[model samples]
Structures are given as structure tokens and as C-alpha cells.
Target: MNYIQKGLLFRLPENNKDFSITTFLDGLKDSLSATLTHFHPLAARLVTLKQQKPPSLTVFLNPENSPGARFIHSVVNLTVADILTPTDVPSVVHESFFDLNKAVNYDGHELPLLSIKVTELIDGIFVGCSMNHMVADGTSFWHFFNSWSEMFKSRSFNISRPPILDRWILAGSDQIITLPFTHENQYINRPDHPMLRERIFHFSSESLSKLKTKANSECNTTKISTLQSLSALVWRCVTRARRIPADGNTSCSLSVSNRSRISPPISENYLGNMVQRLKATTTAGELLDHGVGWAALQLHELVVSHNDKAIKKLMDVWVKGSLLVNTSVHFDRNGVHIGSSPRFDMYGNEFGLGKALAVLSGYANKFDGKVMSYPGREGGGSIDLEVCLLPENMAAFEADEEFMSIVNV
Candidate 1:
């Protein structure tokens, strides 16, 4: 399990003499406690049952021993403008999150499954959350964030969409499959990553619509979606920026949600990891020459073919192997991995201070080609792509004429 780290920044309302940091934090902590009552797993610990014939991992909720969640409140001299006005995300933003920057999800056995840090800026507040990927996926992560915000705003225990805590498993699969690793250290390997730069490229609703229309027209199919169109655009531009050899193989991986792909589809509120990474590979030359529409069609087709049967088959194979997901930042320089979805209401997570000014990600699962997508702050159908690349590649990517034409600075 890898930790999914993200932060939301909000500027404090002006001309308000009734603002007290102590009161705000007290409210946030109290609401978090109430919210955790419903999301029990976040407050629980994951333990390895080595006593079993083969070591297995299980979510352990010990009322007596479990330390609920770690909450830290810190004051920073930075302002909202320091974070929002930068063309490149500042390194200080990483300090907003807890000290689990390199921690894998398995560390939740001893670490807090959920760690929140409320960094008080000079004129704003930054709420950072780090959740164990083992406990949830992107969907569940945002669900918890939204629920916490709702609880804080309403000052009540009632949440609009209560989480469905039931864990999903294949019918014939063993209840506790053997884990591939026995000790936590077996999962603590961290390789040195190349120096990379991260930039959030904003694509407005109109730009996205134009891209989608162009892609669909080029592929002669209306099935290509806005997200796919955006992914295709990034893929092509990044490939070109990397300057890969003509015959070099490059791949694009999209994180696909399994909530609706299975039979008797699981609820959207399912509070666990129900996402699978599907990759479409091609030669770098082919990808760049094919145009955005062709690349979008390839992604669209990949998503369309992953139906209930395919999901079941994949689940069956996974159960037999019981391979734990590696959260390390290992990637081919020529490959692109897209995570998160623009459909997530990142900007709607209001914790009474107001809507978030921007959303930022922590230093986990970030490599040369990592991409995290979020809905634009202004909402509508706009999308924000948090693209990570090598410094040289980033420079080239930002300068690409075709890519910059659609990007809204």
C-alpha cells in the first residue's frame, strides 16, 4: 500500500475579526474525529499475521491500543500568493504533508493510516492529508476528504454519502491470501530518482471540448471522452519532449476505476482500492505521428474492452498471485503513467474557510512521467494536469508549441 498524499489551499476570508486559529483547528480536529467514526479503517492499523501458515495482512482495529490519527498544526510564514502564483509548484508545499513522503502503505501497520497536517499560512490555510493506499484509492481518498469537510461545515455527524465499508472480494477467492512479503522492511526499498520538475497545467473547459471534438472527428468516433482526449494530448507532447528514438517503445498507463466495470457494479462510495492500471504501448515514433485523436481512440478502446469478464479474470489472477502493489517510483523514461481523475471534486472540498484555491500532491509515486489529474478550481469541465518530468524534459514540454496552444497559464 502506497500513501496517497494531497493538500488543499484556501485563503481566509478578509475583513473577518472573528477568526481564531485555535478555534478553527479545534473544529477541524473534532469533525475529523466524528468523520473517523464512520470511516473506521482510517483510524485503524494494518497488521501482518505472521502466525498463520503463510504470512497474511489484515486491517486491525484495536480500540484499546490503536492511536486514532496523527494531527499536526504548524504555522508557516508563507502566504497564499506564494503557493498559487508560482508557475512551478514550490518545494515548501511538500512540507505541508506529514513525514510520510517516502513511506509505503504497509508502513500503516506502525504509522497512522491517515495523517493530516494543517499548515497555517500568513493569509491562508493549507490542509494536507496522507492516507494509506491500502485503505483507499483516489475515489475513496476524496470521498473521505469531502466527508470531513461536510462534517466540519455542518457541525454534525451526518454526511451526504455515507461510506460503504464492506470490502469487495471475488466470490471464490480465499478470505486471507498469503502476502508476498513477511516483514515491512521488505517493502521499504527506495531508489534514487532523477531530478524532476512538477507543473500544474490548466486546460479550460473550452480547450478540453475542442480537443475532444478534434479527437473524435479524427478517429471518426464519438466515444472518445474529454479525459481521454487530454491524456492523449499529454502523452503525445511528453513523448515528443522526451526526445525518444523513433523505434523506442513507449507506454501510457491510465488508472481505471472498477466501480462500474464489474457485474452488479459496486457502489461509487465503496471505501477501498478498486482501481486498476491499464497500459497501452506503442513505439514513440508511432505515437507522435498518429495525432491526438488516434492516441485518444487507442485509450478509449482500451477502456471500452475492460468489461465485467475482463475484471473478473484479472481479479482471479491477482488472488492466485497475491502480489502486493509496489508503490516505488520506478518508471521508464519513455513511459507515462496517469493517475487520479479530473472527475474528482477537488475544488468542492470546503472546510468552512471557503473553497480550495488549489490542490497539490505530495512526493509519492512521482517519477519522470507521472501525471495526476484534478478538476479545475473554477469547475465546469476544465481539467488540471499535475505533470512531473525530468527538468530538461519539463523545459521542452513547456515550450512545445502544440501543447502550449491549449494550456491556459
Candidate 2:
């Protein structure tokens, strides 16, 4: 688990005469403090108990000693168009987030588990949040965000979905297991990476419908979902754009939610990571030659087979080894890792300024072939894919006819 960073852009209030940065910050701080009362783990710290027999790791929350989440307020000399109108995301957008791109989840021991930076633009506001992945997955992260916004808007602490704080451990699995590493520094290593290009490809409802229909018709099945079809399309396009050898292997790893996959099913509001990464591998030739339908079906089967039994089995193996997730080691440059989700309510996080103009990601976990999906701002079934690739590959991918034919532009 690494840091999950996202930025939400909002236009300044129309009645700007009354808008004061001091008032806004006071409201935001107040709401966030109230929100953290329910989601207390965000204010907590990770403690490595090396003296214990197993040398366990724990999330310790001490109300007296806990340093609260970090809040930063910054003023930038930019406008809404500076971010929303660009096909390529501006490099300055990354500055909206806290400079914790190099920090992994274990850094929570000394650092804040959650940090929010409010950037006041010339005509808009960008609220960026960096949350330790060990504290929550996308669902839980959004849950907290939505709650905070709800409280801010309503001026009350009541939220529709209160988080379930009880941690879920497998029935037979050990509650405490030793981590493979003794120190957090072992996880921090800087590696030279290619100059990557990040772009958000918008696919309207009509285009997504066409893609889903084409994929289902080709496969002669309705089991493939819109997300699976979209993912398959990007995988194929990226593989071709990269000019990987036909015999070369490529894989698509999807971050799957395990809330429903568990036996009794965990609540949607569970406040922890209930997600797992599942990968489907195939040669470039096989994936491209068979078309998007074949690729989608492969993903469909992969997701269908990850049932409760499979989840438990994987957890058993993980508990035995206790291997912490390292992004550099786990991610493959040639393969695509689809993260975030279109299901998250990105556009609905309206504080007092109304709906967000757009959503952006931070620099953490960014590498070639990293794809973050968000529900389109217009709602409906449309999707916005924030894709990161090597500069040359991105150029080729944008020029690929088959891939561009379906883009909404």
C-alpha cells in the first residue's frame, strides 16, 4: 500500500466579495476535525513492535499524543483553465498535493496518515488529499472525503454512512504477524524512471456504450462489464503503442474490492483496505490478435474466479510470508495496473463551492502504464481515464487509430 493522492478542483463562489480564505480554512478545519472523530485511524500512527516475539505492526491511536492530520493552505497564480483546458495535465497540478510522493505507508509511524492541501487559484480552489494506503482504500478514502464534505455543507456531524471501525481478520488467520522488514528505510529506494506523460482520456456515455456493445457482440456474452471492456481496450492500445514484441508477455492487474467477496460480506463503509490486486497475463500477440472481446473475457473470468475461497487462500499465504506491498517491485513497466474506480463519487464531493470542476492524481504510484479511472464529471455511464505512459508511448497511443476511434475527444 502506497499513498493514494487525489486533487479536486472547484470554482470560487460567485459572490466573491464575501469569500474569505480565513473563513474557508476555519470551516474546512472544523469539519475535518469533526470528521476525524469518526475516522480516528487517520489521525493515528503505525507502530512497529520489534520487541514482541513476532515483531508485529500495529496502528496505534492515542488521543492524548496523536498529532492530527496535516493541513496546508497555499495560494497559486493560476486559473481554472490552467488545469481543466489542457489535454496534458499541467506539471504544476502535482504541487497541489503534499510532497509525500516518496513516502510509503510505513512512514505513517512518524508522518500524518492523511494530509490535505488547499491551493487557492486565481479563479478556483484545488483541494488535494494524500492518504496513506494502509489507512484506507479508494472506497474508504472517498467515504471519509464525502463525509467531510457533507458535514461542511450541512454544518453538522451527521453523515449518512458511518464507517465500521472493527477490523476484519480471517477466522483462522493470526491477528498479528511479523513484517518481513525490520526498518522502514529498506522500503525507500529511489529508482530512475522514464519521463512519463499523463493525460486524461474522456469517454462519453455513447462511446462507452459502443465499446461495451462491441466487446459483448464479439465475445457472444454479456458477462463483460463496462469497466472490464474499457480496461481491455486500454490494455490492447497501450501494448500496441509500446511496440512490445508479439511474443512478449503483458499483463493487466486490477485492484478488486473484497467487501462482497468475503463470506458474509463486509460493509461498504468498512474503514480499511478490503481490496486486492488480481492480474491476468497474456502475450502481446494473443491479446492484440484476438481483439478486445477476447481480452475482456479473460478479465471477466479472472474477476469471477476470485471468490471468498480464493480471497481466504490468498490471505493465508500473505499471513505466512507477511510481505509488505512495494510499488516499485510489484508494478511492471510494460503491464497496466488499473486503479481507482469509476464507481467512486468524485463529482459529488461538493463542499460549499458546489461541484468539482475536475479530479487529478498526485505523483505517487505513477509509472508507465498506470491507469486511474474516474466517473465522468457529467455523470451517466461516462468515464475519464487518467493514463500515464512513457512520452514516446503516449504519443504513439494518442496516434493509434483503433484506440482513438472510440475516444470522445
Candidate 3:
């Protein structure tokens, strides 16, 4: 049986002067084996007993095909750094940044869809997580993290039982449901490379709170939550920052955790992709005018609208059968990002070594940029946003007067 799970990659700068490939793998293997056992005993047994399948594994085992137990598929990416002093956290931890200058081309079929090439650079590190959009959504990624951490630390991992759906069950449903795959002129060739940008922004708790308040007050609306506000703010900021025209074609796409939002939340903690995109757009002036709060309401509606039965039917039809193969509709738009709550507090990313000093991540193809909403520094009131963007765009943003006024554009 051949199966491939997209790999998520990250770069960790060399912290101390020492690192051992063999020793690190040793700890990771036992840890991953333990986690698989704890999380899905059956799957773990299949693996341990030489049953469950991994792409790295052949139907028949060869010496090289043996399962490498580490949940983390890792490697070392080396680069030249600017200096040779004792590395600090940012220097060591963020060395991923330096290696990012390398080329990435996911133009053809490949497995472990995501990968991290960690390099020791002259100035810093280059970090990224390249994965197939199918293997795991944000939530599943964290599940793997939590489980991996528990196993590595040799601690009891108490995981909230994830709802399990046998693939056969979904297959049965297909017999009764037909999805709309072909419409008149339905398939438009996806752009060769949409103008997707990568950016990361940082905000102190105070800035986030004030921004939320400003969004609410300006829109004359009260229902705007922090996420809604922030998303809208980012939309506006990027539009203005990138000098995208007011009438430029764009969409603000984000995720709705079907966990609590749906009638019978689909699955509590499944290790697979379970998410829908909420893509909404507005004229630049309208976006800037209603500001974050109003745009947030628009966002709310886009998602709620999908809750109807017809939409579900459409999805069942659209995603049915072998009609669809691996697809990553990577967009090249100037100002869109997959924004999310980093959910760091949940990932017990501890190895036998220690708590991870920092987590550096990026995505595949042209998803423009990415934004992660994380807990604030003090653990209360404040919110922290880690934004990843092109250095030049960032420079333009820092210097733009109108843009600075929004944040102070």
C-alpha cells in the first residue's frame, strides 16, 4: 500500500555548538512510536508490528524502507551567516530566515508535500513548512505536535479523543451523492503562479486591542471579534501597503473551525483536513471605509451563509471520486493570507531536550503570505501576531505615511 502524508517543514537555528543526527533521531523515533501508540493504538500497532503504511515504506520492506520512528522528518540546511559570535535566541532560533532565499518550486507531483530545510546561515535561519493542503489542516498539525511532544518527553499524553471516520464510511456516502464538477466553462486554468506574497507582522497586545477598538468604533458595529477585526485590518493594511488599487480583485479568505460552529461539530480532534474557506471581497474604499468591524461582519456572513444544506451538497458533489486528484489552488494575489490562531499553548512541542525556544513556519506555493494569531507576551489581555512578508514590502510599509497613520497609517 502506498500512502503519502504531506510533510510540514521548519528551520531551527543551531542553538548550542553541538547537534547529533543519530542521537536526535533516536529520541524522536521512540517518541513518535509512543505517540502513535497512545493516540491511535491500532495504527501504532500496525506500524510497530510492521503493518501500517508510510510512503517512506515499501509494500515489502527493504533495509532502507524501514520506518524511521521520528514523527518529525528532519534535516540540516546550512548557510553562511554574517558573523560568528555566540548566537542568541533570534539568531539561533530564527536562522531559518536566512535560508529562505533559496528557491522553491512545487510545480509537479511529490509526496511528504511539505518539508523544512533548516540552514545555518551567516545572519540567521531559513524556516518553512511545505505540505500538501490535504494531509492536515492547522488543527491536525497541532495534534501531531502535542502527541509527538508527549512521546518525546516520556510523559503520559492525555489526548481528547478525536472522532474517527473510517474512509469506507465516506465512500459509502458517495454512492448516494453526486457533486457538480463540470459546469458550462467550469474549469478555469489556475494561474501559473498567482501573486501570492509571504509576510509576518508583529503586534504588541496594546496595539491589537486598540486596533480592535478602532475597528469597532469606526464601523459603528459591536459584534466584531478580535479575529474579524484583525483579518479586516490586515486586508486593509496589505491593500494600502501594496498599493493595490481600490478596485483591485482580491478576496479575504480565512478558516471556520467546524468543531464548535457546526450543528454536530464534524470532529473534535481528527488528524486530517477539515476546514472550509470563507472568501469575501469588497472595493478598496468600502473595505477601508467600513474598516475592520464592518468587514468582519461581512466575513461572518460569508461563513454563516455556508451553513445551509445546499452548500454541503455542493461540497459532497465537488469533492467526490477520482475526478479530483491532488490540488493546491495556490493563489498569487497581492494581499491575501491564511490567518489563524497559532494555538501554541495547545501544542506540547517539548522533546526530551526541552521546550522549543521558537517555532518558525511557512507554507507551500503561492499562498501569498501567512499570518498567525498567537497568545500575547504577558499571557493576558494582549495579543501577538506574527506576520511573514517580503522584506521589501515590509520596508515600504514601515515608511508609508498613509499606511502608518492607520496603525498610527
Identify the leading candidate in terms of TM-score.
2
* CA RMSD (A), model 3: 8.4
- Listing every candidate in turn, what is its Cα RMSD in Å to the true structure after a full C-alpha superposition? 1.8, 1.7, 8.4
Error of 2 at 355 (Å): 1.2
TM-score of each: 0.95, 0.96, 0.65
Please write out the lDDT profile of model 3 over residues 159-187, one tens digit for every residue.
44443533212333543332233331232
- Worst 10 contiguous positions by lDDT, candidate 1: 56-65
lDDT of 1 at 279: 85
Pairs with backbone N, CA or C atoms under 3 Å apart (clashes), candidate 2? none
Better of 1 and 2 by lDDT: 2
lDDT of 3 at 239: 65
Give the distance in Å from residue 98's predicted Cα in candidate 3 to where it truly belongs: 13
- Candidate 2: tens digits of C-alpha lDDT, residues 199-269: 99999999999999999999899889999999999999999999999999999999999998989999999
TM-score of 3: 0.65
How does model 1 fare in lDDT? Answer: 0.85
